[model samples]
Target chain A: MIDLLVISPILVPLLTLIVCLIPRISAKTSDAISLTSAGVLLACVSWLLITVVSHGTLTLRAGGWAPPFGIVLVADTLSALMLWISAFVAFVVLIYGVRSGPDALSPGHLHVLIHGLIHGLMLGVNGSFLTGDLFNLYVWFEVMLISSFILMVREGHHSQLPGGLTYVLLNLLASALFLSGAGLIYGKLGTLNLADMAAKLGALQDPDLVNTSGALIFVAFAAKAALFPFHFWLPASYHRAAPAISALFAGLLTKVGVYALLRLFTLVFTPANGFSTTLILYLSMATMILGVLGAVAQYHIRRLLAFHIISQIGYMTAGLALGGELALTAVIFYVLHHIAVKSTLFLVGGVLEARTGSPDIRHHGGFYQSSPLLALCFLIPAFSLGGIPPLSGFWAKLNLLQAGIETGRWLFIATALIVGILTLFSMIKIWNESFWKAPASDHPRPATNTGGRPFLAMLSLCGLTLVFSLGGAFVFRLAQRAAGELADPSGYLDAVLKGGTL
Target chain B: MNSLLLRIAARYLSWPLLVVSLWLLYRGHNLPGGGFIGGLLAASAFMLYELSGYGRPQRGFFSISPFFFMPVGLGVAVLSALPGLLGGAFMKGLWLPGFELPLLGKVHLGTPLLFDIGVYLTVIGFILLLADTLNDESS
Candidate 1:
């Protein structure tokens, strides 16, 4: 049902939070609801993905108010993939939180805040994916951002204060820009709905105004995605949060931003603005180079991985900017691949930090010697992120490179290769420092580090990463098909406009 | 610190501002004001009262957790959207027969109005909640 597609994802978590508010329920009860809700969401998303994949885009108009007057939740292949990914990541994190020990996040309203953030993110992601209206997307953006703000500020670390401040200010500025862009689009087009705007955009008389609106909107997504200039906030804030939370943040948040950029540029604004394509390509290259460089310079494992996230984000954009069947297909594949690899690295990094009682790489060594299993767990995804063969990252990269080469983009192909190498470099840095070397001294380490549970969680995530890599054929093909669907937005526009499919 | 003009202004300003904001909230359906603007106006009115120290309700000062209200606002907003699914489509503005209020004319109220009110409470709750947190941090 359209209702199940749009509302259930959000409804499930919100219901759990309400149950959590009651005092009679203990931690066990809340965990059951939270975990069960995640499970239901997973089941729903899995079925929905297959349905949307077989059939074309599906639309659920809010209140069935028809086009230009109502909010619509439309699911195509790409959005479905993203929804599936978010649900999958959240489910795994919930698993880790349960199986692992006490969640290390500060405890004042922590549970509520965590659950609330999940609820908010679930709504925001679905709304962004499903929405066919610009304003509706903005509302979802606010929902997601407010949730992130709470998570960012919750622990109240001295370090987090500036990071949080910068994050708040930057995102607020993006919000304002987003609002003004919406106003401009609404004022000029006389319609805020996405599909309607597309029709109007194609026939626009004033190139400057339309181009300006398009640029502003892309800027908003860029800021959210943390592309190059917009990316400084990520490493700072992502590094400061607790690991499980960091794992979630690293995995899901920026991808939403990228997803928006991909959706808007590929579907709505691609025809109106050609300059955005070239501009985004150059920015993507810069983001890639700088992100990898920034990662290489960092010693703290998570911070390094966080920096590399932006670099890999560049790969996703590369596929879109090149703008052909292969390139778009590649972008979709890269997006999915990066989501898995980045989250694994962040979580594994967390596991390492947890075991060692420090995040700095130089402060520790010989993890592989003692906790050989955990070291091996960290190695899989790290190597995969570097694009070693048979890994998902490799398949994702090969496609992007192939897209670039086929388009005769030598420089981009070369840059993608360099970034891939650098990705390997940084991952190796993590490996050599944190896991590979012999211990410097005879100091005693924690029992948990020596014990195998935390390592097991990281190992489980690594296993998933490997699955994504080995099974890259299936997901990459889905991404290719989804990207094809996105390249042509006519069917999507019509489906949402009329209640029934076109 | 209280002044006669200041007190009169504070008393009049708070209630009037509150009233106007509420007006904005109701009229948002077809007017310039909506949940966001109305909530902000209402919040500003209460903020003025807090600043003027007209009522020294320490308990009131910290009564409702604003941070907590943000999620509540979110819940309200989401709940407001739930009625859409049962309808023929998503967000289809469900309605019952128009009920006549005592003073006003035929108010053909619907879920949009409920959604608006949810937006109102959420905004009011969120603003004050953030304000409360920042205040606690500073003091």
Candidate 2:
């Protein structure tokens, strides 16, 4: 029964994808089915979180085969927390989609495609989180890329093709690099199961070969996560996607890359040699500095948020590089906070775009006077993303800063603080241009409707962001617990290797 | 490419090609051949038939929309895992004992075989859909 619960979050959405694809299913029906599936997934993962909290880690082997041979799904605290966050964001995205996405799809057959895309995305995200095998992780990445590729190009906009091309090519290259790295590890250690590899790699005589493979894998993940030098592909591609897609991608996609970094860097490869640690430290500072600079330069709403996503990734990497229980706690908390805050901001962008008929701040104004509620919804997440006090990001940033001080990484600490202030500047730029300034005569101020479905979607997401703020103490404790589990992966290994029946 | 020769060959060759594909599919569980190879073979035969008949091959048995096959195939593939849920796992294969049949010597059935068939249908549907779309795009 527990085994059933562990796999249900992945399986239910997959079943919905298949069901929604059946011919004659209308868009309305597909939407309803997807929403129900998202709701069901939320409930299941919330239960999974509780179970993992109480019972260490839950492992379920597909085809009932034991680990080190067949694929295994392991839901440790980190995986459960990530899954729960993904589910929550997905639920909100579904509501946002109903109001914003109908006209974006290609009408009849494509309706089913949208639901399938979401399901495929969820499957990949959850699979990546829960699977204990490296090869299975690659397969899940492919699933995710395929779904995202379809979604990115589904609207067939002229501007989207270039973005889609760049997105696909870079990701495929990353997959190749990842596959070779997996092959290298398997050749040396004879195991692709993460737990087994973690146990075996340390004992192998060829440390350099293991390090090489680890570097290859790290580069691939960095490219996926869009860290510093590898980040050019992100803003170029993400801004061209549909706003809802941008939200989904912003909220869930790259974070999967960061999650992989957290999982692999801590558990699989210890980074004790300081090779990865030093590299991560330098790259993260560069990423933070460069990303905020880019965000500050952007006048496009989605583009600015896209760059901010890159900057925020820097904070997560800094946490990982700092390498303590507290730092990892910051990593987890920042990830959770970023997912809600970023997605909420993007949804707010969607609402703004709907109201003003432009994504550029230069073309719009006076939202604060017209709809203070939208302004408030936008401001909460914006302030939180900037690491303002009492919001979730402040605590997340504070934890990172404390860890930085302990580790004596003064440079990164300074970079993070400066980035926070710059993020505030960028957010205020949006405020001054879009909400605060009076509307110009050329671009007439549209009547605001706070009672509409779009506003309601924004409100719900705003409420989620507020949860991160109001429940900060509780959330911080949760992050601390999750980070403790991540710091020691023995429980994860034991659950997969010993708890299952062959 | 003599029209008459191509037509003769396509018409005469298609049936045997399909037979071979199905044979490969049936032997897939233990042998090298499987649903993916079998489906490709069937698609090749169908494509051959279409080309030889001037891209106007009429539907002989299945007349539903071509999109029907893709979804149904996926549905079957996912549904084959249902029995595994009963066993407290997913995608775990369950088998029935082989039995002698009237015409065939022996018949074996299992969820894995059902899964293979689903894969086969999906591959066939995928190739056909691609062929149709490309063909539409060209003209």
lDDT of each: 0.76, 0.84
Q: Per-residue error at A415 for model 1, in Å?
A: 1.5
Compose the digit string of candidate 1's lDDT tens values, residues A1-502. 6566655655676665545544334455556677788888888888888878877788776666678876677788888899888888887777666533435444544564466466666767766776778898898888888878877777787888988888888999998888887898788788888888777777775667666877888788888888988999988888887777788888888899888888888766784443357788889999999999999999988899889888988888767788887888888877777777777777777777776677888867887887777677777878888989888778878888888888898989889888888889888887888877876564455656233444455666777777778777787789878877787777777777765452
- Recovered native contacts in candidate 2, as a fraction? 0.68
Residues A53-83, candidate 2: write the lDDT tens digits.
Answer: 8877788888988879989888888899999
Name every residue pair that clashes in candidate 2. Answer: none
Instruction: Report each candidate's C-alpha RMSD, comma-separated, in the order given.
Output: 4.0, 2.2
lDDT of 2 at A257: 97
Which 10 consecutive positions of candidate 2 chain B have the poorest summed lDDT?
B56-65
Model 2 misplacement above 4 A? A99-109, A272-275, A444-451, A500-502, B54-58, B62-64, B101-106
Model 2 CA lDDT for position A73: 89
Badly placed stretches (over 4 Å) of model 1 are: A14-29, A98-102, A180-183, A205-210, A271-273, A442-444, A449-460, B1-77, B99-102, B105-109, B120-124, B127-139
